[model samples]
Target chain A: MTDIKTLETASSPEKLNRVVIEPVTRVEGHGKVTLLLDDNNQVQQARLHIVEFRGFEKFIQGRPYWELPVLVQRLCGICPVSHHLAAAKAVDQLVGVDQLTPTAEKVRRLMHYGQTLQSHALHFFHLSSPDLLFGYDDAVAHRNIIGVLQDYPETAKQGVLLRKYGQEVIRLTAGKRIHGTGAIPGGVNKNLNQKEREFLLQDIDQMIEWGKTALELSISLFEKNLPNSRDFATNETNMLSLCREDGGLDIYHGGLRARRPDGSLIIDGIDYRDYEDYIHEQVKPWTYMKFPYLVAQGREEGTYRVGPLARINNCDFIDTPLAEKARLHFRAFADEGLVQSTLAYHWARMIELLHCTEAIRDLLNDPDISGTELITKGNMREKGIGVIEAPRGSLFHHYEIDEGGLVTRANLIVSTTNNNRAMNESIRRVAIDELNGRELTEPLLNQIEVAIRAYDPCLSCATHALGKMPLEVQLVDAEGHTVDRLYKNANGDVSLCKIEA
Target chain B: MIRHFTLDGKKIPFREGQTIMEAAQDAGIYIPHLCYNPEFVPHGSCRVCTVKANGRIVASCTTPATEEMQVENETEELQGNRRELLQMLFVEGNHVCPGCEKSGACQLQAVAYYTGMLAPEFTYFYPMRTVDSSHPDVAIDYNRCILCELCVRASRDEDGKNIFSIDGRGINTHLTVNSASGKLGDTDFDVHDKAAQVCPVGAILPKHEGYNIPIGQRLYDRKPISVVGDVADHQEE
Candidate 1:
């Protein structure tokens, strides 16, 4: 829950000064945090502004419907496979395919699990681990991956190997690691060959062990910090994700499930195609990104969280044994309610990583994965929608095609966009908690970034149009006098570069 | 005796009535081309095979090889011009290679690579184009059409069915089907027709059979187009 009383006192009607952190590092795309402060340096407001727009939705129009799967891969370099699969699922509907063959489904699942494994491993290990291992307040020079490598070589090596193993799974399943042409309109293009299966199996056990080790490391770090970690940037927001018919954690495909902070179901087992009936996007004037909320809850109370933390909170139970055990441990952190701490995202992400490894191992052993029956045909539909749980959160891709099989319109609500409001809330909470009546320093700036990094938002995937991002910081009083200033360019070079006239 | 022409300062022999491309192909020389298939009468719509003949620019596919003529095939200036032409072709239409099934096997992409055209210099037109998938087996994507007229020539001359034609002019010039409804589904075109298999780009394709071959194993993936030498021609019915 938000501290409305404290917020009201801090947020005076007087115009507050601003502190801008342009180009938050260790994340996917271009974004900045603007913290408004009063004359006493008390934080008044904070917002995560998405400064870049990639107009993928508009540009993809007029393309052939079948090309959507491949074309959407240009959306994000980090999670292109997620986009690839989601668009493929949507295209399947246009071609009239209600269901795919057993072989095709299994192959797609393998690819999705492999993608999740790689994406989760990337966020937890390479990007956010420095803040978790070396305290968030550590010197800027000593709080990077390089510093972690010099200090804890073994941990860094495990992170690299874990990410590499996931990438290998993607390469074998999709044909290429980055922009794979595996999943197609109605099904997958190919199946795992016997040789490919053998290769993946060679190190499947090692991957599982690494997953477990990573989960344990995250658990130890979170538990050691205890109350401090639990209280850091905590907020009570709704959670949303996909769950299997049996109510197990499902990343690839399932019915929609959203839960309130008090563990009450807002919506359950609803077909994701009807998501527009429940979810609506609210436009804000300040940023290009749109804020999505539950239509029933309206704008203010409707905003919710997604991604690992939300998925873990929303699922009834995880299917894998190891992951189920880890989930139970994670859920118990909040006792009678859902875990609302932003920092707990890393823990929940590791649990999913462990599950991905187990799922990959099981998929590799399945005989259906090698079967050649790959495609299916159905009655054509004019409109189609596909939704999946990407690494960041729930991703939706909807398209309308004319009789000629050409795309007339495209609407994509990416995972990062779903968390737009939640990210802003997290930043505001961190700013008020860490920066009130304090001197502005690099570590304080990093704390705000650490809160935003928890969601692992991809700004490039979130935006729907083109915009310029000018990076500069100025502390101006109510009288409009510049008290201080800082600047960061696109190349990440920081200096006292003067503002353009 | 065959007529002799010095191409790139090397003497090459050509028979009477043979064009410069024919002479190069017959003499074990490779000249990059898209609209000039050896099996068809020369239709020099795509000037990818342009060369310097006696210090004057000419389309080699249609230009007859002359005795004692100096023709420069692989000069730096010609290659540079060819790259610019390829870049123009790229930006003139929506030719997204990664999404197109013909990516690894596309001759246009290969020729661009052979000419060292790394990126399209011009802004993409992104013209609104229609895809005609009304046909049961074959589909045409107007966006990828490079106005080569290879399919038009192949259908009219070889298949004996004038099924496709170039309509409009300049940027509006587009491939149109000769049918009652302006659709391929209403046409007499068959999968085995010469026009169906003659598209040098991804303009025309067979349905339900795209991306079947893995990327690395496609026709142009294993070897550059300079070595493959129009192997995609007649490889399928």
Candidate 2:
């Protein structure tokens, strides 16, 4: 990861200008970024710092594994399903339940897809839409759900419907929206009935149609507003995702596939069980969250992206017809099927919504959905890994167990954290492009926020914050080497250099 | 004496220590529950039962039948009671039902509509109470408390810790953290305690979560509790 330092400017410059963006607002959790500009007013180096700690993994050590789905779900409400499913999948792996019958798989997939739809809808409509539809210069108060509703009632209603449909799917499958109990080791506890299946099918059809309209509206709005055509895009050769043998769109279940921007699949069909072989987590003292990178590729060059944009970019084809059409439309915006701009995540998410709906419809219509024998019994034996594509990105849940099937060790790689490196890069690029030589207006700052929100990053899942009050940020320069540091107390402050080091 | 019934066309037997819901799970016939935990004593406050024992709608959690009896859990009248009971629970407390963390996983909220509870006919009694943040990890906000007793029971029975007790009486009777300081942090209580994890309402919240999961994705945001059914069935195979 430190190899990027070669790209850093020499600190021996006669003078340097330092710009600090502190406590980026409207986001759920706390994060900060500091940019060091040379006397020439060009961004010399950028550092992203997450400043909070709650210790979720540590807290869950002695607790019963059964409580994990509910407990971990509280990690982040934005993507509770990611934690819920991760916990369930981990427990399942620990228990060595291999045979996930068709019904159980369908139910789990439905719940997973439901979360993806709702989370993506929230990101595209409520969070990022304000900048695209109403412009970032709008007042802060009017830049939320209310503004979106008042400005674009039709779009807002579609968002509400789309989100509602997803929530309903989750509820039906899991018993509640946020932290449900349906997901278990062998199979989901809940099974869809004919009536519920019909309802979901009908709702999914409507969502697909509504999603198309929303996509058209988004494209028109983007075209009309035409967010500055600056080259805020980064083509980091490291891109990783879950893919099938045929390289089709794989979300709920697949193997890890690392590919280059040039479309060559490097590590295809990486057994999730052997995740430790390719990925390793680095713990920084400054943040409670751990940064994971492709071990084989090494840190600096292994700057892979995830979520809708990465998934779309890496996939060979989308299965559902309507979604395939939207995928094609998305491809039209990118060069060589690579969407480098973070702003395109919205479009990619919208396409994913359609695909989820279509995929859900297919799953619901499957004859095996209502089967009685959902769970396949198995005794605790070997360690295993469960990988699924969370709404935000690829989620990996790995567990090791003793003879009794109790989890001895668990390592979770959430979707949000998977995109952390890319998110930091995206934020740095957008900040440099938007803030360089420009007045620090609220609108311009909001635009930078808009770019970050484009990834729909869940900072809470990234960093667990207990009752500790939010921290303050400071910008300091050691000679010409500028550093951004966040402090809980003045004496205990950790420098930005430590992060890169 | 063992009790027997036909649930969803399958005949199942119930043991002495088992509630109808537990018996159903053991027999592979899931019955929905919100306040009844095998780890804790059953609190049949939600009344989500269409259970007809000898031709009368009774709360299955509290009802113990004798001899060979016919019970109808899927009837319209039983569904009506379940719905009405849900409405009562909703209106009695500060169940902003939509924004609650337990919305999706909440038994009370989901069972209400699953049994055809369309709207609350009664007036909502939004009580005001203080948030007991004395504990470092757990938070207890009495306002959102539904008097489910899951916390009280779990604290006493499962953890063998009587750290929580009910104060006042009737509608005024609310769960109080059993510490001299009256704050969660002041007590030995942590989120890992059964008292904290078993809260069916948003009354007891973990300090770590705030705006992490949005309101839309909260528990009970999806289908009703009847669908998720019993917890015993969710155990690892």
Candidate 3:
């Protein structure tokens, strides 16, 4: 078991001097990290600022309840399946179906597994590998996928192949890999074909093996980069994920579970619709991202995390045999009941990947996966709520329909949005630790980025909106003035182009 | 006498007073369109079917087909313009195709496929269009409306209820119902009405049968927009 000790300090936002990394890179959305320092360059405040604005809430009014599933998925291409499924669950209540057909349920589950697998692979290889492989403080240009390829060509190929397998799973289950139209309001539009099944089945064993390989790789990373994995930032307050009644790793349909930093269950297996009873959202003026916390807990104190790390920590058991074994090893890493090291999120992701692949393999062997009955229709209702575990976190889609069954009001708490407070806190802590009153350098700035990246913070998805992101990090003085800025040039090098502006 | 016009290098014969769209349809060629339904009086609101004739752009559904016209229907330049028009439609409204029930059959999505425009080139407006689900059988999603006017024309000319009409100007132009309340249930627009059947987008949808047809088996999924007849020929009911 990993040793337990309080090896880090949290962020203290007191005075005004600031350092900023504008338009943060290697993350999904537009954001910046601002560090407030004292006169002696002592760290005071570190904040992750979300700059992009999207008014999805203002616009989606007056759409039909049945359209909610299709509309809300437009939030993020990276994890549209999560949004699509969550909204579909909400719409299912409006459609008046108590439960879906067995086949419909399995197909949806398959799609979810595919989504989780692909998204996890993407974070591990495409985004975070450069930092882990080349070292966070290495040359910015060499700390990316290209660098991974240059240093470890075979490893890069395996990453691409692993992602490709996941994509194929999506393409076979849904119509297209990204933004697929497979799941509808009541159930799904189609079921898997024998050919599609065979296509996935042929590669199932290989995928499981690759998943094991990936898991080993991730464990090695945590073992090697212990400081980066443990020390810099700790957003260990509380965690939330979905778990089955038996405490199995249930990603699609399950009750919500919330755990304390020690990994003891505060609440387990509660209906998702009751989320408001326990959690509340607090909006801050500095950023569009809202901080959701344990009800009445207040801002920083109420901070909790979602996503892979939380999911791994909160769950009691894994349903699948192989994944259960991997889960055991991951659990052993915890000194107490939870692993507070932000970098351990990468390890958590690999465990989920193993589970996803194993789950996919088992789901295929079941004959019911190809059933023809894909939808169930019933009397329409006026109000419905849907919740599902997205790759980033727990997602909720609630809609109120008129007598005509059209949506009058919609409120969505996306996965990333659930962790806004935690992400901000994590990035802040990382920034303060890496910058002990020194000038902002590429390596120091990257430490903060790695902290944010640990959450795989999908700001675009979290904002309930979507767009392209170009991020920059900067240094600021006492009166809130820009000292310097770091930008990613065309060659992927972090270039500080402008100064003293 | 046979009057011939070469469209995309194909000799397509046209009858007098017939628009380019009608001629192309008769010749088994699909010029991607959204608003120009054969049943309604041609209202070229959605310029998705715009074609270039003699170096000048014209709405194929409204412009009369003349003899021996050199029409550029399936060319790179015209298709590029059509892609932009589709992009404008996409960015202006909340046409979330992947989540839409009509995604597999939507004319906008189909034409987008036919034009090879994989994704929109502009920013999404993420309009907060309202959905009118107050009706018992049918629902109206304003976000998916391309302002094609097909619903308006069908409701007015065919159903004779005048339940729908054009309500705004310029980019603000929108579709509105004639009911005392803005809800669809308050209006006489039933699921069987031409207005409901005439929608080329997912804006107007039939309730309860959302995922009846599997996506890959849906109309546009099996055949491209170029092969299937226009929106009118592929009505769900």
Candidate 4:
């Protein structure tokens, strides 16, 4: 958890003279970083500050209990389904509806997998590929979807097609792709038909084939760049994920587990309802987002990462054959134990994508995919918690309701919040090691942004609706005199780039 | 005789045999709708005014008002259905929204625009259809018609013309001219009629004023039309 403090001149004379990177760039959401330096220009304290204020918690109060799923689903476009499912689970819990029938469970799992596959695929191919495949300083035009198509048309086409499959799965199961209407308190409202099942199966087969080829291409690219890419593997952080006791792949649903770099599970079967016990949230003066850290380890050593790398590290075995093959290849390079580096996360995401595709295929081919028993009737009475391993990390939704079925209380802890401590640590480490001796250039800035994006942080998901981030940087002299200052507007356009001796 | 029920937790009286929509309107709680007209017999085809009755969501336009029943308007499930229905309407129609002359005035576009539908979730079918410039004063573009049956309703109930009818099913179901000749000009259709003006999308555009009102100042330009209102008082019977 972050410790908020007001900077005082008398406390540390040397610290008064520092340079701060007020705003970070190339990210979806707004955040800042204060880099303190001594009189000798050496680094002092590096603090990553998230400076966006959104009150989704406060906004959702007094809303009808049943409406939460749709309301929360709009929280983030990238992970709308995650929020929807979590909200539904919470409602289900409040309604005292647990243990969905096999068919309903299978359909829910299918929908969940669709989101995971699409979201993970999007991050790997569109978001992260620019840094890994193309250089960080690649032109803006060449850094987006158009660029991907131009550079690798087949790969780009496959990515689009694969995403379509994932989206189609969501559409078929939920009735619509974005902000779907399927998952209710008891179960889903929509059911799949025979034609829809067949369509999904055919699409899944194509996606699986596409995923296999994409994996091979990605591995080859990584292999060719391994020696040069070694330095990218900088930050050493702890890993947290949801996994089974036997250490098999658990993505859609599972219990929480925390582990060190050596594959030793420190905390296992941590009930999501009791999440507040293991994780602690603290407020920073600059940002409304609460930084949550692992309580047992404390903030300094409590820095732990979640998402694909974390999941790969915590699990001993994978369910799918294709995923196991990818895992073997990944382990050959980074070892089988808990790998702490953020760069390895990309590989983990690819492995998971492969696994998700295979799993989706398996689920689609099941006879129950077209079952009529989709929604189960139930009454709302008891509070419940819904925990799922979203593509980015662990997602938890807890809700309390009155007997009348109106939501009295709702608490959501997204995966990105869980990685806040680790992200700060990673940023600091990269700043110290990569930026210490290097000149402040556009490439260096891009590298810094890439390091943060490596975790695939969903900033929009983190901060609900506080708009436009303003970035201000200040360089101070030994006497605490402002030597240089820079200001950037909400669109990340530098408004003032000035320097004073 | 009147039917009474709770709406959004408030109790109100509805006409004995009136639709839930009519009752809600009589109670001054406007339910968002597109197809239902007070003059027409309830069609319940659009599925936009779907509300929870006895814990199950159903179209309020067709469901009869019942005594002491609980009805939830604008519930999460209903909202989802409404949004999805709007999305389907947007994608299914040839509503080239930005360029349409009746964009603001069109009821289909009005409901969609008010609902905050920025993008269509489903893939655009982009079905093409020929515009019938057959009528002297009006043109019917089947592409942008959402099959809301508003035109059909107006023809049969309001104008007492019965010149419009719907054909097909599911996603393919669409409004067709009620003439064996299959042409608006060939049929006993008059462009000056209210049915022509009541056509929701640019599907039924005025032939003379094709590009007169810029898309922005169209149907919903001045104020939004209430879906349900005093329908009990305006009852045909």
Instruction: State in Å the error of residue A388, model 3.
Output: 1.8
lDDT of 1 by residue, B175-236 (tens): 99999899999999998898888888999988756666765678888888888877445366
Which residue segments of model 4 deviate by more than 4 Å?
A1-26, A37-41, A139-141, A225-233, A284-286, A332-336, A462-501, B1-237
Clashing residue pairs in candidate 1 are A96-A378, A96-A379
- Model 3, chain B: what is the TM-score? 0.95
Candidate 3: regions farther than 4 A off: A1-16, A225-228, A296-302, A462-472, A479-488, A494-501, B1-101, B108-131, B141-184, B208-214
Superposition-based RMSD of candidate 2 using all C-alpha atoms, in angstroms: 14.2
lDDT for predicted candidate 2 compared with the true structure = 0.66
> Candidate 4 lDDT, tens digit per residue, B88-179?
87887766654344545566666765565667889888886655655655667776787877778777877889989988888778778877
lDDT of 3 at A427: 69
lDDT by residue (tens digit), candidate 2, A1-501: 223343234365235545555565445566766566554445566555666665666654433344456666777776777777776776666555766888888888888888888877877876677777777777655666677789789889898888888898888887777666677656766688899898888767688788788777766765664445224434354667888778788777777888776666668888777888888877655445667888877876666888888888778789889888877777777656366666677777888887888888888988777876666566555565667788778888665544323245666777767777776666566656665656434565555567667767776554333223333444444454435444332222223322242
Interface RMSD values for all candidates? 2.2, 11.6, 2.4, 20.4
DockQ of each: 0.48, 0.03, 0.49, 0.02
Mark the regions of model 1 whose C-alpha exceeds 4 Å error after superposition.
A1-14, A462-472, A487-501, B1-16, B26-28, B52-58, B66-72, B75-77, B122-139, B159-161, B167-192, B207-210, B231-237
Q: After superposition, how far is residue B31 of candidate 3 from its true place, in Å?
A: 6.3
* Model 2 alpha-carbon drift over 4 Å, by segment: A1-22, A26-28, A36-42, A221-230, A233-235, A283-288, A403-405, A462-501, B1-237
Clashes (backbone N, CA, C under 3 Å), per candidate, total 2, 25, 21, 7
What ordering of candidates by DockQ runs from best to worst?
Answer: 3, 1, 2, 4
What are the chain A TM-scores for all the models, listed individually? 0.93, 0.85, 0.92, 0.87
User: Which one is best on DockQ?
Assistant: 3
Per-residue lDDT of model 1, residues A428-455, tens digit only:
7787778888977767788888988889
